[model samples]
Target: QEGVKRWLNGRDDAAFSRWQLSRQREGQFIDLLLAVRDELDRLYRQPLDEPSMGQRKARLFEQLRERYQQLKQQWGGYAGFDGWFSHDLNNAYLASIATYEAWVPAFQQLLKQAGGDLAGFYAASRALGELPSPQREQRLQALLQAADP
Candidate 1:
């Protein structure tokens, strides 16, 4: 019985660690997404009728492409960005901005609930994820409600 308890505890610990790592990766993704969004916004905000608009857009795209190539090198040849910039830039910017706007407040609330304990936040997130779909949605809604100032 003691051995079984130990094994279960070990499993739970591993799962918690995975969740923590997942959250870290998610934060990285959000950071990259925001950077891309900002670059696209800078291009979009320029007047279409500006004399050098095409040139400016081309310069911005080249800059963004260089950044993406650097990121790929940093990430050990990760191809995640291969088609990221090929899509409609405005749609991509809107989606990224929407994700950031929606994610930050909920993450803050989770941190608050955990009293700033990252491990505790991961455990809570794992628990919520383990619930049935309906229950998970309900719990998420409650958390969002509590998050409201």
Candidate 2:
């Protein structure tokens, strides 16, 4: 095993190898997270009438939450200086996710108010969708006005 090899190779050697492995895992995680987020973004725009849209949304949510929780668990604890730095950035990202999750009900309500048709008001709002949530909300509100009249 890599760990066994590292152990036999000595402490300094182990440290570098350990860091290398961690960096590799981090890269893999980032690629996976980006891909899944893309999936979520693409699938989320579907109108409710599509037969499999609900299933797709559910799958995306499950994937998102699983990765979110995995990262939280993976990075949650103290790991001296290196971890303290990553921890700050990780916590900031998780905080944003928390804020976004809190908005889910409101987003769903907006869909309801639109009578569940996301394409009309929503399709015209992709530029806003690319913004951060607060800015996106403002842009979406402006788009809604345009879409309506």
Candidate 3:
């Protein structure tokens, strides 16, 4: 219970939102998620003050790529480990990596044509919008139910 409490990261639910554990074991998976979240928040909070598209391309995207790389590393270890958490993380990693891989080139091209206009980059990037949640998340949710009280 002590470990699970820590794993919950102070959440009352204690559920992974994707599993109803009969017993709590090592909370490495949740810890990894927290690490990923912290890193993302760290990177996202940085103000991208690059005034020119070239600068934005060089600096902002470098940071973005770095975040993705961090995620890739986080998910890589558990990709095929044959559990719901591993499955979910790996799926997230794969989808996010693929989408970002495509977007890097897209952003580069957009920056080239953006004529130093951040709005142009914004307009073009906004076209990509939000991607649908990966199927694995749903599967994991279904797999999770109320834990035995």
Candidate 4:
């Protein structure tokens, strides 16, 4: 919707300009979040048994830290911008959190049904569970560390 040149092409309409900016920020946030999540999935798929867990978890946190910074820094990208900027951010955050909560439990149950692959599933879930808040950094690291054999 944002690429519709007729609507968002010119800076003439302040509302349209704001809408474009908000869309850009939203895209950036989603990109970063997805990238971090993809890395988590990669970690889970790796065949390493024990020693690599700490290293992998550390890398995951580093990627997440970058994503968090990206979100926080670009947060001001919508400042004074209009067209549901705050609403978009809030909704995105809420949706991300809610989706994770829904996904993790359902995923755990699915893993159990498929047999015991808790380690692989939890590896991703553990990282995602830490993402909603900064305070979980330490605990998440510890959990990931302990997840190692």
Candidate 5:
């Protein structure tokens, strides 16, 4: 718990810095996926409404392919992200984005509730973790709601 508190508070640790860098890279990847999804939506919105679901899906895929190629070229032909262009991967990426968007603010609120005290924050976090699954989720939801402006 102490180690986690240190890491969470951004203490001077090489591994923590590396973890932060990896998170930043993940954020960049999420941004790229979002851009691709947005462009595809803008380009293929009309086609997506076609009566034939199969045709609409085909059109969507076609646009995705075009946009992906453009993205690759924009990134100076970096193919390391080729695996992220799939339908399943895109869904997973979106889910991850949603989770991050929801949880970060809630955690921030929890920290604020602790008055920036790391020990208090850890104790509060442990209390939350010890709750039953449903209760834990309810508490998390409450935190999220409280964090909302």
Candidate 6:
């Protein structure tokens, strides 16, 4: 009975430690998210102050591509190699969605502040001067299929 009680107490202490570690990780994740956003803001908004469409488009695309690269690196590590692989993926997905949400206002403000047509600029931005919508969708679908665990 005494041994069982000691084991239970040990388990409880370990569980509490794990819970604390999880909270610390969450805080770090938030910090990472904020840092990414700050990078995006610096890339997009600061350049827009001088008002160059080409530069704005380039900066925005660069930031978007960087985020995608970062996410893939975070999420797609080899099995049993990366300790936080699953956690990284989940955090990346959440961060990507949050970043998109953050962009809504920045985009709106850019259009209003710069007196540009937001929809037209965005449509052009989406095109990225290459493949059409259908081809892009097909490529994305293929990538998603490939990415499945």
lDDT per residue, candidate 6, 45-131, as tens digits? 553555574456456445544554565466453122223333423334545757664444434443343345556656644653377
- Kindly provide the TM-score of model 5 when superposed on the true structure, using C-alpha atoms: 0.50
Residue-level lDDT tens digits of model 3 in 1-149: 32344467447564643333423222443334444544544544677554653454345434544554454466553333234333324324634644543334445554445664666857744653442456533422332322111
Off by over 4 Å in 4: 1-12, 50-55, 70-149
Report every candidate's CA lDDT.
0.66, 0.55, 0.44, 0.55, 0.66, 0.49
lDDT of 4 by residue, 6-107 (tens): 556675688777777767776665565566556666676888877796677666656665556556666853333233233423224534754554344445
Clashing pairs in 5: none
Candidate 6, position 128, lDDT: 37
Quote the positional error of residue 44 for candidate 1 in Å: 5.2
- Residue-level lDDT tens digits of model 2 in 1-149: 23344455656776777777666566555554556656666665766666687677667656655665566566664232234234323323534555554454455455555666666437534554778989887754554454432
Estimate the TM-score for candidate 4.
0.38
Clashing pairs for predicted structure model 3, backbone only:
none
True-structure RMSD for candidate 3? 19.6
- Clash list (residue pairs), candidate 4: none
* Winner on TM-score (1 vs 2): 1
Model 5 Cα shift for residue 85 (angstroms) = 5.6
lDDT of 5 at 111: 85
Candidate 1 residue runs with Cα over 4 Å from true position? 1-26, 39-48, 91-95, 98-102, 107-149
